[model samples]
Target: MLAALAVVALATVSGGAAGGWVASRDGAPGGTPASAAPVPAELVTAAGKTVPGVVSVLVGGAGGASASGSGFAVDDQQHIITNDHILAKGRNGSVTVELPDGRRFAAEVVGREPRSDLAVLKVPPSAGLAALPLAKPGATRVGEPVLAVGSPLGLPGTVTAGIVSALDRQVRLGDNRHSAVQTDASINPGNSGGPLVNARGEVVGVNTAIATIDGNGSIGIGFAIPIDQVQQTADTIIGKGG
Candidate 1:
């Protein structure tokens, strides 16, 4: 099932599904696993460069309704890019951004486009956030390794690795249709609006949605808004007094 995603009010994450999978380094059946293999050097370098620019977006709505998602710094002006669905759920309530270093600040909505399912926000210049680098338009290739960085289920600064499963995939986002960058990364609630970066630490897309089995958790299928579209939309918004 394809469902719009978000973590509401920082809801509690269930561990029932997590208990089902088991790994063993010694090849023993049902035995606990030893230390996992070392992460590749490229991925380590990518994560190091990416994490600091990502932030946790928390929205507080009326009657205690709220939603959480992830966003990344898009420019030196502290402009941010995130999913519009996150703001829609908040119903025009206050928006707060939390940096990776535990600093929090109020954010102002620059603009939002429902058709693109994208929005722009700006923080004070004092935030001093470093903007993430972006890949060239149409530079992404299938089978290339990628990283999905976000705050899944409210856990901030989380990173998952996978490959670009496909590109130019037709998908419905909100009331509009878009050609998305498909990936096998583990995208869950709170991962919305985060960056799907390439091996060189350059953003290729914005992680937005995932396909689930029988309305369950992610089953390795995820989708992202291509960076070209994101950049265009963000530029348009920022240009108009953002």
Candidate 2:
């Protein structure tokens, strides 16, 4: 009887009856020198203008499977960009995007590239969907002030200020070469797929991963997918035959 049930459970999970699994840290890295800067009111104001594009994505399904993450609008048509891990379950689940003005809408996965951990979603166009301007990847300088905007730990519209610690940092994620923008910004759980913008409010990267330990949290080592790659992928996804 137990063996039969095990098989049934596996079949159900494989058949999209179970929700997608959330990504977790292996362990936190050791401490590093603080590089956080006082968030300027100007930066906050700039972020406020951009934050409307940053949205909270809620994925839900039957069998009590659900997950949440962040995403950003990339175009005037309500095209959204996010990490592939956030929408891995495909049509088995439903996605809802919540904007800063308390408006929410149903979203659909238009394209996904798991190797780069990027995905594109689509929703209906509405007012106040300010798309963030994309910055060149090689343009970001080390020690430059930056900010991370996302729903960290499910806190909507959360903003954290820090500096770009490095650029073109290579993080190996399961046979994929992820050239990332490293920052000292505090990116906790639920921040995946959000924007990592420079002081000018131009999006330089997409926050994807962070280093953490069992007891320690946010080791100051956070990684984001470069904006250039994001654009390339998004263009292909939104383009014809994609």
Candidate 3:
């Protein structure tokens, strides 16, 4: 059955988990059974590498309206990439970015491309956010493992695991039609604009929208803007000094 598409950005007042498992012996007291499936080491490593680069974007708009979503550092220049719709929800209001460690900074809107559903924000150089690596152009393949790293439901530093379910999936984002990388990762509200990274900790796409049945929550189907488009648009916005 066809499902409705949601932007995955949470609208509310500004407010905002780690994934790790310890291996236990066959009968270790109060420990997970040794027969339990182990978490993939690659995914664990990727999560660690990605969390620090991801940030929570809080927008305070006119009349106390606010919206929150996720973003990731893209360059050493303190530029962060996020979904433009999140900014739209705030009615062009002030933006703030909160680091994974709880440090918050006032952010300036560098630029936004609504058609592409992407936006860029810049914080002070003192923020010292780490830039996430991007996968090579045309590098993503179907069936590869991936992680959706973002703040789902206002919970910061959240990571969900899944695989590339399809490539070049046509979907509507905002008012534009674009191709997106489809995955089964659990992309919920507040995950907008966050990075979808591969097992090697390289960004493959920007989590943007999810298809939900009956306006419900994520049903294992999420879409991300391919990283190549993100890089091109982000570069143009940065170059134009927007």
For all predicted structures, in order, the TM-scores are 0.87, 0.80, 0.87
RMSD to truth, every model = 5.4, 9.5, 5.7
Q: Candidates 1 and 3: which is better by TM-score?
A: 3
Best by TM-score: 3
List per-prediction Cα lDDT, in the order shown.
0.84, 0.75, 0.87
Off by over 4 Å in 1: 1-31, 34-38
How do the candidates rank by TM-score, highest first?
3, 1, 2
Residue lDDT tens for model 3, 1-242? 65655544333334421122322324435746568467799999999999999999999889877888899999999999999988988777899999999999999999999999899999999999999999998999999999999987677898999999999999875558989999998887789989999999999999988876666667788899999999999999999974
**Whole-structure CA lDDT of model 2:** 0.75
- In model 2, the number of clashes is 3
Give candidate 3 regions above 4 Å deviation: 1-36
Consecutive 10-residue window with the lowest summed lDDT within model 2: 4-13
